[model samples]
Target: MARKAYSRRARVTGTLMLLVALGAAGCTGDPAAEDSPDAKPAGGEATTARAEPGKYQTLPQPCRAVETGTLDAMLPGLAQLDQEQRQKAYEGTSSVTYDSDRRTGCRWKVDSADAGHLLRIDFERVVSYSASVSDDARAQAVYGDRMKEAELPLPSDPREEQPERRADDSAKADRDEARATAPADDEAGQGASPETSEKPGKGKEKEAGKSEEPADETVDPSAPAEGLEPRLLRELADDAFIDDQLTTSSSGSGQRTVTVVFRTSNVIVTVEYEVQPKQVAEVPDSASMQEKARELAGLLAERLSDV
Candidate 1:
């Protein structure tokens, strides 16, 4: 009985030792465990989590909420003419304001020539403003010259408050007369009277009027063909960097033309080349034009930054 009791005590001691060994193994932590194939390191710190490579850093000034009241104040007066007249002469359809750490400015979209033109105007105060017109020369012509002149009178009450009713009426009358005198296909074959034939100058005048009518009919003076793509322009303007391409092709001879504009906040670079008569032009030949465009874009971008 004594030998059996001692054997049971030894068995209990061995069991306790085994439990301690198991507990120690469970407590051990391996620092290299995360290095295993199945384990993933925290985001952004891992070698596989690098950002995609690209030119230009993120913009310093992001677009913010637009100021409609400021825009209204800045908008050129259209009160001199009727609504239809106003729509034809000016292109301030939509406006927005953005805030940057450095300054605040406004952007607007105007449709011209069935395309979009982006206009950005930066305001220093209620009385002072600066403007930038994008790549389109036609847009620049109207906005820079005509619209700029018109807006000079704004932020003030004009002494001549009367609407130009006579001007509007005369324009409408001229349009109607032009439409009436236009010749149809059937009318082209008809012979005129002896009196009409004698008065050749009068008939010529009528024919000239007919020819002019279509120009008036299709012309929306408010919107012109040289307008900018306002939204795209705004995006490009707001971005710290932009790389975009414009391609145009001629159907007559299967000729193609391409223009690329690459820009940064301080610089704009353009590359334009033509593929015509089934031949691509040499880069050296287009270098001057491209450089000129780049210079223009850079200057415009810098000016726009102020607004």
Candidate 2:
């Protein structure tokens, strides 16, 4: 009976030792096991920033955004050629939009004797659903993408040429005034000293003065100045760009297209103007079309600002 009791106690001791060893193993976690996929963060959703509200809450009617006179100027002969056509041109086709306040567009076209013009204007009011991004920022992104597609030349610094030109003109005017007064002064001095004969010297001085004066350069309004190519514009809105392209039509006529895109606050505006002559060989002028398109864009931008 004593031997049997010793064997039972030994078995009990062995069982206790096995349990203790198992518990110690469980307590001492393995580094590799702790780094397993099961230990990773749940769902793995990264925190993001909240978006801001847009500046513009509403958009204007695209069809009537531009004035009748402006349309007439852009599309010449719309009123003169045909009444039906004039009505059609004045009342541009509005784009179908589920939410007019969010986005809208209008397009108009008019054909004259030898040439035709088309105009399309689009207005978009950006809405930010995200909590982190602002409406203006989103619009800027969209505008940036469009600008990339255009790949236009860099815009010229209007300030750079304008101030220089003004200064030059002022200097030229001052020189002219001085020259005009000089003749009077010379004549008066000569009259006072008629006997002191320096006529040859006076003539030489006048000729030298004339030679030193720079001749006025004739600047054609239609010509785009050096370095002032049609390009992505800045300071017009939050951002803006003008894209001008000349392409040959299927019939071999030259088609000139001028596209202007600008973003003001949370609203974006696009103006597309094109001119194509009936004769395939006749090429359209890019500078004139670009100017007209930019003017139209400016008008539309002003209207958006008012809204």
Among these predictions, the greatest TM-score belongs to 2
Ten consecutive residues with minimal summed lDDT in candidate 2? 183-192
Candidate 2 lDDT by residue in tens digits, 209-291: 99999999887533345644667676588788887777775666777778899999999999999888988578777667777
The reply for model 2, stretches above 4 Å from the true place, is 1-51, 155-228, 250-252
lDDT of 1 by residue, 20-52 (tens): 999999998777885677675567354443322
Give Cα-based local distance difference scores for all models: 0.38, 0.81
In candidate 2, list every pair of residues with a backbone clash: 49-132, 50-131, 50-132, 51-130, 51-131, 51-132, 51-133, 253-280
Candidate 1 to truth, TM: 0.25
Q: For each candidate, how many residue pairs have backbone atoms clashing (under 3 Å)?
A: 11, 8
Model 1 spans > 4 angstroms off: 1-4, 27-44, 52-84, 92-262, 265-300, 303-307
